[model samples]
Target chain A: MSYRAKVPKPTVKRLSLYLRELEHRVEQKQPTISSRQLGDALGLTDAQVRKDLAYFGQFGHPGIGYDVTNLVDRLRKILGTDRTWNTALIGAGNLGRALMAYGGWQQRGFDIVAVFDQNPDLVGQWLENHRIRPMSDLAMLVKERDIRLAMIAVPADRAQEVADRLIAAGVRGILNFAPRRLDVHQAVSISSVDLALSLEQLAFQVSLGLLGSLDEDDD
Target chain B: MSYRAKVPKPTVKRLSLYLRELEHRVEQKQPTISSRQLGDALGLTDAQVRKDLAYFGQFGHPGIGYDVTNLVDRLRKILGTDRTWNTALIGAGNLGRALMAYGGWQQRGFDIVAVFDQNPDLVGQWLENHRIRPMSDLAMLVKERDIRLAMIAVPADRAQEVADRLIAAGVRGILNFAPRRLDVHQAVSISSVDLALSLEQLAFQVSLGLLGSLDEDDD
Candidate 1:
């Protein structure tokens, strides 16, 4: 059974960060963590931490906090990183190439096994262990490599078409970096990493005049 | 004064997408948009849309809908896009260098005017209009260019120290690609965008089985 089916979108996102932090705590020989403790570590509120964890069947105690090792394992299982997944990068652009080289993706349970590009210059090159391929071979690659997840880092204009092709090739999940929202079939779950939105999040905080000057750096 | 400080995190994210759609509606000369119509366009519920928007300020009418032009303006102001921003980038790795070359950042109101790196190999290289500089010159760059925002695409281990230096130098907002939490004083907004989180989100979706074999070409 998919553990995520029962969880909300916000809960799922927070679980990834929480899992990482829990692993760190476990390594530090911390035996238990309270909701407030975890929240503090992440700059979140105690209630928010408890509410997010509650979605996955109450892993925390009333007062003693949560067992570090157990929470990590439970969250890992819920996030489906208990198994390995083969991820394909559809564009060999700078962002896609950087992602292939990031190294954290592998540690987090993903392999960028193949890369694609339409340009002759890029297609002939090798990225890490994977070789870049011409776009003509995408379908063959999807079948041969059994890649179920595709990351679309192509330009905005081609993002939708590239996504359509990835879906056509049987990929079920897509993480899009294009500025535009992509249209996909009901079965495809696309999550866009809008760089603007990330920056805008900061801009909103700046507008608050919270630390308009240098006082925020004192702590 | 910030309409976003009152809205939920998820609501703010959805508003970005909503504003994009609202702009299109305005261009098409649509009279107004009802909560139901807005929800349908984005595959959400009418009540849910109402709830999300209500957190900011009431822009939708009781019986009719929202004024596209007015709503767009409200969203822009809430998002803090009333003026453009100049951004600096630290650690001109492949990711940073790629971002400098990409035109998307410019369109999003952030100008990539400066780059910093400790690697002497890239110190003299030109990225678009800006030359990569040695780390020693970071503080001066922040002041001379009036750089309020920065993008840190450095390695995870170096992220905190680099961010600390940036914060110390008076950077108000940061978009970090580092996979760790940053401890900073209040008023300074720091957001870390982990590449693996998006993949994990997809994995969670797959494990949950909310999406079936989604592909346009799937038989």
Candidate 2:
């Protein structure tokens, strides 16, 4: 069977998590998994897992669930992570640096080909054999090295301006770690990864005396 | 009406973003906003914005959409961000330093109180107005300074251990920027701010060729 490209965004976000769970299950040598089992691993309900998978055609068994390896491949192809993604990290700060050193990127087939920082002292430095070049090199790096994915970790004030530069540098996709919202062009896609908001959210939940909301995600 | 301690998690997250947007609108002296206008500003559909607001009861009018100032005040009261959140940064690395200097936290009602790092060099060091303290002082500062929220910007290898210390020090909620997942007890809430997974999700959306799938909310 051929793959389709009309998967929903929510389904795709959940799919990456599903693939991670499936990879873990596959490592355990589990040949097959029920939607319930996969759901348990990724915090999705059995019905949601089954329903989400059904969007890409029937990929699971009626009672047995899904084949772990097969489903991983399907999600991989659908997510476009099946191919290696040459990513570039902007702002070699702690979060970006931590990410640059993370093992999970390689696990998911993403290569941090290059990184750029605006600091004069930090620029021309080395991060595990990868050079931290100046922001001025973004355009050159994007065109020369085929860097399509850019991660912005600069200060909030510079977030929008840096995004504009990345867009001009030919970055089609951006993962902004900066807290400020960037006004990227319509052609560019940006997702702001805010750590504080997530914390405030959990705090708000804790403050609300609503622990049961999370508990409801039981598979 | 007394504050309810059980707003939905997704609702709280959206409310956080809505409050920020509404604050801007109110500051601009926009007397009213329609559900469609709010949706347009936040990149959500009119129906979604309305449905989310409806969960908190009747906030928007049938014709006027919603009074920007009234809705902002209401959302603020609901999300508990009407007051400031004093947050502590664990690990004074590039990410933590970057975040402390980031300005959006104040815009969204999050304030950084202190920073902790195990590194001898970083500890007892000063970054701007904030001083970096040793890990041994976490419990003291958290108790004395009333720091309830923590942002973990440590390396993946040390994230879990740092989390244990933070939880023991009376940290109620955590926004984890580290790549690895940390396990915590039910009493302590932890939200993973994974940058790579976020990008992969975006790639999945772009691959699907569905713009609707990537529609983001302030949450």
Which structure among the candidates has the greatest lDDT? 1
TM value for model 1? 0.86
- Considering every candidate listed, which one attains the maximal DockQ? 2
Per-residue error (Å), model 1, residue B212: 9.1
Clashes by residue pair, model 1: A2-B207
Tell me the spans in candidate 2 whose CA falls farther than 4 Å from its real position. Answer: A1-5, A92-98, A118-123, A134-136, A156-158, A212-219, B1-7, B210-219
Q: Report how far off residue A14 is in candidate 2 (Å).
A: 1.1
- lDDT for model 2 comes to 0.74
Single out the weakest 10-residue window by summed lDDT for candidate 1 chain B.
B210-219
Cα lDDT tens digits, model 2, A1-219, are 323344544565576777778888889999999988877767778888888888876578777878888887777787687787778888877666766665578767678899889999999889877889998888998999888777887777888888888888877678877777676656676666776667667666656655422322222
Query: Model 1 segments beyond 4 Å from truth?
Result: A2-5, A30-55, A58-67, A210-219, B2-7, B43-56, B212-219
Docking class of 1: acceptable
lDDT of 1 by residue, B84-178 (tens): 78788997887886677667666667777789998899999987787889888989988998989988989888988988899888888888887
Per-residue C-alpha lDDT of model 1 across residues A54-169, encoded as one tens digit per residue: 87776688889999888888878867788778888988888887887787787878887789988899987988877889989989988998888889888889998898899889
